[model samples]
Target: MGLRRKLLVSIGLILAILLVLLYLATSVILMSSFSNLEEQLVLQDVNRALRVLETEVLELNRLLRDWAAWDETYAFIETGHPSYVAQNLDDAVFANLRLNLMIFVRYPDQILYSKAFDPQGNRPAEIPRGLYAYLTPESALFNLPHPDSSVAGILPLPEGPLLVAAQPVLTSRYQGPVHGALIFGRFLSAAELARLSQMIHLNIDVRAYDDPSLPSDFQEVRSSLTREKPLVVQTPGANSVAGYALIADLLGRPALITRVVATRDIYYAGQAAQNYIFLSLLAIGLVFGEATLILMDRLVISRLSNLSTSVTRIRTSGDLTERMAESGKDE
Candidate 1:
């Protein structure tokens, strides 16, 4: 091949290899990094949702403790005091407490009082039959022996899931010989879920662990909930990710699943950024390759071509005295 053609081929080959390497590195490393960052962000949002849910449970337990450890409540459980219910369990009381159901169970599983209320309307309602039936001698609330002990959990009632708290009835001082247990429940209604979602800035869903209607991806994530860390999974063909955490009942069985979903805006943004970077690199490579080829033509290939022309002229005209031109520049 002629000198200029050979130099062009050599430069083209090197630039092609470099460009391929650049593309591979960006695709493999940078893309993977962006994916991991997106996953981490989703995980962070899920963790925030988990923390908010935990705080709600804790608040319920604290409210239960306040009501259960009161002197009037202790007396009402034993004497069936009509004045106590008329005074304490009234509409204002339920509204202030934000409780849907209140149950006072005497020792050995006797339900002294059970009432359900609508906190929004501050009106009485029928307690969920499933919840009423679930409170038996074997229930965790009735089995508590210590006045200081309390149980808080999610329970799937016929109406819906409830965040329930139970505490052994005692004096306001948390003092002993517990007569029974006082239970409070807050329904996990649509309003409540919306409030929680707003608080955490993510879409949240609470479902029974064995709920058959859960999406397949959610079920797959839930299956991995045995792990200590929350399970995070990308929803198929969606621009969002989901995270799952198991909420156990008072008896320590997985009762509810908390799912948090967040969009992958950051991932898409990262991909855009990577594309920009790749384009910038490609442009730079093109400029660099062009400059390299121009310099080789001016400093090396041109001189070699001149030498070849001189040799050909000498061979054809039989004049060995012909000399080639030389530039002042060093090779």
Candidate 2:
């Protein structure tokens, strides 16, 4: 009803509105920023997974190059040297080198020698039935545009898929009237995938290009070769997210899909921080509002109240000569 009460109400309303707006703005901005940062962290994990897998491939290439460009391998391919096979292509050698398959092909598709091994079983293994049939003249391996250049890629096998590397057989010096091609392969087995997962502390999933069960994000990644960035998605029914990247074989065909997933620890941490900030701000607003109201009541509202009381008394008593007393130097 009076000036002091009206001023108190108006200031309280303004402070309350400002506090609400500040809280909403801070929450929205912080939540959005934290969401983006979590997405970036998922992306970084995916990139690290890709790098580790690529390093494995490069190592395979190096090993294949060494074996392919060896003098014994060249001599064995040319002359069927028994000693070379006896000394070098044994189970111990395969186990030590960690190779799943080794094939020696004499130029235009004549298989000089082909063998598959299971290092885990410590015994000989069979190549995927009919896989060699695809190595005919029309195949990518036999039809290499540059016969001298080396090739490495994924090959679909009955067991699953294999990472393969091939090189033209030459003397150890890498000189050649290329005699033939030598191939080395390693299967992408469960053990291998587990090893990779442990290394990066993320789950890894691999799918065939045409797998009907492939996730939508993975399919999107496979639809284009130029898509350098992975498709990231939050996992359903889990506190985690995944990023999908398409892997192409040496022939530039989408051969495999890889997904990297990480837990939402960072997201959870950000959320906790945001909640703490909101609560702290609310508490601060309450304290500030109380302090401000008290100061206003003492410094401004109390003085105004005294002036109103004196004016009212003069009005009621009909004393036109009466003067209101000054409260302090503030007047």
Candidate 3:
């Protein structure tokens, strides 16, 4: 082959090797690093969502404390009178607070008064039957020793998961004879979840952890999560990534699953960067290869071609007088 063709082939082979290395470095190292960073950020978002839920529970507990320490509530638990319910425990209170339940119970499983409301319907509703299971004599909701005792956390029920709190009934001054326990509950309904999502600016989904009919995605994540590995992050689609976590109930069992879905902005940005780098390298290689061809032609190939043509002419004519010219270059 001619020198120019040979030079092009050599340069092409070398550049191809370099490009392969570049592809591997970008795909394996650069993108991997960006993927890891995206996962970490998603995990952080999930944690922030969890903290928001915890704040909701804490707020519910504060509301419970306000009622539990009221003198009217302290007397109503003993007297079982309708006057307190008439004056304070109206439908408007539940609607305003968005509360689903209020229960007054004496120690050892004696329920004095209870009411459950449906905020969406703007009416009173029956309390979930499963709630009584937690109110058993051996239950922790009412099993308190001191007047300052209070408890709150998630409560998973067939209707839905609830944010529940309980406190011992006390005088308005926070003084206590510890008569009984006052309980309050609010379901984490769709409206509530949407409000929470707005508050945190993230898409949140919740599933019952122990339910057999959970969606495949939730089941997949649930099976992967353990006490040791409490969180799972995954990419379900090209445009979005999801983070999963387990929420334990007041009984310390995994009762609910929470998933946060976010856009793949970080990963997408990395992909764009990779494309830019590859294209930039390709352009540089082309420029370098062209420059190399020009230098070869100027410094070596053109002079060699001229010498060969002179030698051929002298051989054909049988003339020894002709000379082969050389350039000033070392070649």
- Evaluated with lDDT, which candidate comes out highest? 3
Q: Which runs in model 2 stand beyond 4 Å of their true positions?
A: 1-9, 143-147, 215-238
Q: Can you write out model 1's per-residue Cα lDDT over 272-298, one digit (the tens) per residue? A: 878887888789888998999889887
The C-alpha RMSD in Å for every predicted model, in order, reads 2.1, 2.9, 1.6
**Where is model 3 more than 4 Å wrong at Cα?**
317-322, 329-331
Task: Tell me the spans in candidate 1 whose CA falls farther than 4 Å from its real position.
Answer: 120-122, 227-230, 329-331
TM-score of each: 0.91, 0.87, 0.95
What ranking emerges by lDDT with the best candidate at the front?
Answer: 3, 1, 2
lDDT of 3 at 46: 95
Candidate 2 RMSD computed on C-alpha atoms after optimal superposition onto the true structure: 2.9
Put down candidate 3 lDDT per residue, 50-111, tens digits, no spaces: 99999999999999888999999989877888899999989999999889999989765698
Name every residue pair that clashes in candidate 1: none
Per-candidate local distance difference test: 0.80, 0.78, 0.90
Error of 2 at 257 (Å): 1.5
lDDT for model 2, on a 0 to 1 scale? Answer: 0.78
Q: What's the lDDT for candidate 3?
A: 0.90
